[model samples]
Target chain A: MQELVEVRWHGRGGQGAKTAAQFLAEAALDAGKFIQAFPEYGPERAGAPIRTYTRISEKPINLHCGVVNPGYVVVIDPTLLSPAIVEGLSDQGILVVNTNEPIEAVRKKTNFQKGKVGVVDATQISLDTLGRPMPNMPMLGALLKVVPLVKLEDLYKNIKAKFLKKIGEEKTNANIAGIKKAYEQVRVG
Target chain B: MRKVVAMTGDQAAAEAMRQIEPDVVAAYPITPQTEIVMGFAQFVADGRVQTEMIPVESEHSAMSACVGAAASGARTMTATSANGLALMWEIVYIAASTRLPIVMPVVNRALSGPINIHCDHSDTMGARDSGWLQIYCENNQEVYENVIMAIRIAEHKDIRLPVMVCQDGFITSHAVEGIKLYDDKQVKEFIGAYQLEHSLLDIDKPVTYGPLDLQDFYFEHKRQQAEAIKNSLKAIPEIFAEFKKYFGSAYDFIDTYKLDDAELAIVALSSTAGTTKVVIDELRAQGKNVGLLRPRFFRPFPKEKIVRALSGLKAVAILDRSEAFSGQGGALFAEIRSALLDEPKRPLTVNYIYGLGGRDIDLQQIKSVYADLEKIVKAKKVKDLINYLGVR
Candidate 1:
């Protein structure tokens, strides 16, 4: 059987890659898929590149290992465009990179010969909207456009479940606005 | 009824502990073993089980917390692995010698020098002399069942020693498999109430815990603890029978598979036995006489049973993960050789040190183990054979 629509998140350690993976799964979990979101540990001090995963399926996941093959590879940091991270992009997979650069340049660094490439200047979008250079919210918006399994409403509901509990409503609304602007600026394949 | 789900060894242990309803569980996070503590932490967070979960800063604090909790007359539990267990080395013996029935799951990992994390029996091997009732599980399913059974064995009126339900670190702790948890009613009925009244902190009935027991009175107390630990030998089978009557999972303290007429046997503990069984069966199909003797409980090591089981075999290979620096063989080899000394007819026993420092042991290595067994049976002088899951 085709398993969960698995997505791999690539970013530097301080850049909220694990948070992005978790929020993606939580958003889709509210849509009723049994999801597993986990971060693979690394030397993972402040700025080391980190890899994480989000898998959304109609069935329970028994495998807790890394996402061996992914449906979408979301690179939160464009500098992490290496073959090591994108090694197992499934034939029909999509690569979403957060950079103002051309799609082919990003594609040149990856062995993902079959992925439909997406490029977005998420830092500029986040700073313009949320006033922080958090690429997670915007990269997620790009991810939603490419993978469309989860509705926009479910993402906010799940984000509120996480952020609203930690920060207040004002910061949550700012994040939601950042996500909204991301939907407008984040490129579609 | 408590639900059936696919879970790792640690998750199953946490769930089963909840089902049996321990009063307090204090544990700290350590790799391969962290999952168990995290599982219980979630239980404490969700309030699915009404057990007090204490989060400690380190393994020493975790064991210390468990000692305090158990002394206060609560059925307390905790978990650790490798160096973490090493860190708790002094306290583990104290918990056992004091006769506190705290059940812990030691997710066995390699002890560190170069700092690695994976599966091995070396950690528990290092703690073999610590007097804890050690029960090594062979699979994810057994890890769950053994956690429940360990509590029963540890808490038996005759046996008040703390039990360590051990499994190979990531191999069992992180590997997901199918397992059924007992319903609260069944587990509650099976384990019954934890009937102890020695609350060290109770103002109404004041008591002292861990007061220095000098040789005279303390020696007898140590003897009594040893007696309690030994009494588990009988209780293990009886409790297993009762558990089988309810849950239909019949287990032996020492499980002997096809040793009946086998010429050779490979003995192992923890998750290695699962893959070893497959090797045993494949070799059996080819008419090669090989079997697995996986001992579930280790403290009151089934010395008589092992001697009796090996009576008919021509050769035995004892696999040990922990090194015995001063000894001629690994610790397990010494124990097995010492136990079989009284047997009238015995096999030529060999010691094979297969895994250390969390090296992966696959079915290929298992198959290779059988070939070594064949050679040992033929020669009877195959001592100190190091099976290299590590060398490569």
Candidate 2:
């Protein structure tokens, strides 16, 4: 990983975009790296579009403004994929989406030709594993496949430790299963 | 042993409050600040702290309850944001004038009209003269540290005043970052125990709290309060030194970043200062000789420390997150300019009223401010006394 890696997550309200960003940052912190995570708050309601940011670095992060040029953009809701979503992404930045569509189709939708694109059927994966439509965990799995900011095992340990108490054993295991499935199935091109 | 944990500024404040384990916590929930109340409430529910948590009806009631609890000789604490702090205005002043050592973590937010719930310094800046010590924080770690230190500052023998530990709403309050927390035993030992000299609950010696001394001693009493604040200027350093001895991180009224030999610098506060440091580093990498001076304490304004830090600078841009509406400039700009009046060789300073109403101030905007400072250094004068940055 580089000295600093900034990731922006685009998701709708109630989809856990903010949670995913925080989870990634916390996992980075557990791995002995400095991190920051925050959501761009607005007049938000359920199903409303929201953006969250995560920054991981070897050194302390001093920048407090919104992440403008993110090295990676994760779109948890496939409906949010657009040219605007790719705006301000670095030329070499990677875009990951939780869509059942092929990587080519996702790239065509976002017009994000500057860098590689990763696609995964995270919506289906979440439904199959968690028995619910929570793509946040699977989307994070897809993101790590492209960037590998934190090791998969470390992220799994963090998620299990963080969620087991709040979500209980069965749901926590299911969430972890979804992550592993998405990690294995995500296709990047 | 100190523990490093990733938490938001609100969480950090609550964690500090948990460690302090005040006798009473009377607060009403407000956005950005709601998390602190919620986090502490969880601790209370989980039996982590022995505190009487009061879920007040309104912010007015919150401050009123805090005043009551504090006067009764119970170590007290509370948390609120923009409108919440404004709503507590009446009791807020009373809490300070009555000299109750209440500590409140004010998550900075813009006051309403159009009714915005976003990051701004207008809330606490408005209460600048409410006779409370105001300590601004740059990040979650600072938020945690400042809240702990405020207990000592507010409850000091010479400085029996309330304190508002302010952090930028959402910017730091909601942002999660790694923070180092001291052991509960260490914090307890550092703060010791609150022992009010004249407790209202003391039956043997009755004391008057809010009495009307119309023409006789009101002026004299107010003078005593003024002296108390001034006394803090001397007492705060000793407390800070004590904190450093225990925590290993030194704090001061003002924090300077590479400003000693720099020709250009930016003066800012809270999270904006953190962002400015990044810009300073980038500019310094290109040999721009730029730096930053961040004021940690706003109330009892650290004029001497600030002026001393910017002494050798050729020019500076003072960034204000809230407008003073004085047609002169923002509150910080006014304070900085006034502080430089006595200095024979002071930096040519310009005021940039930016980030009002929670508008994002990016690195480019900060860099541009430095660029303006460089221009001012060449011109040897400021073109505009008050300029707006990142504003439409």
- In the order shown, the candidates' DockQ scores are 0.07, 0.94
lDDT of 1 by residue, A1-189 (tens): 245688889888888887888777777666666666666664649889877777777775433334567888888888778787677786688888999887777777876666698878888888887788888888888888766868889998878977997988988888888777777776655
Q: Write the per-residue lDDT of candidate 1 for residues B1-392, one digit (tens) a residue.
A: 44454466778787777777789988878888887878778877888888888888878888888888888888888888888988888888889887889999888887886687866677887888788888888767788888888888888888888888888776557544445667778877888778676778789888888887786698788778777767888877899899899888998879878888888888877767766776777789999988888777777888888888888688788887777774556777788888988787888887777667665566667777678777776676775454434356
What are the iRMS values of all candidates? 7.1, 0.5
Q: Which pairs of residues have clashing backbones in candidate 2?
A: none
List TM-scores of chain B, every candidate.
0.94, 0.99
Give one digit per residue, the lDDT tens place, for model 2 in B245-344: 9999999999989888899989999999999999988999998898889999988788788888888679988989998889989999998989998898
Over 4 Å off, model 1:
A1-189, B1-3, B201-208, B383-389
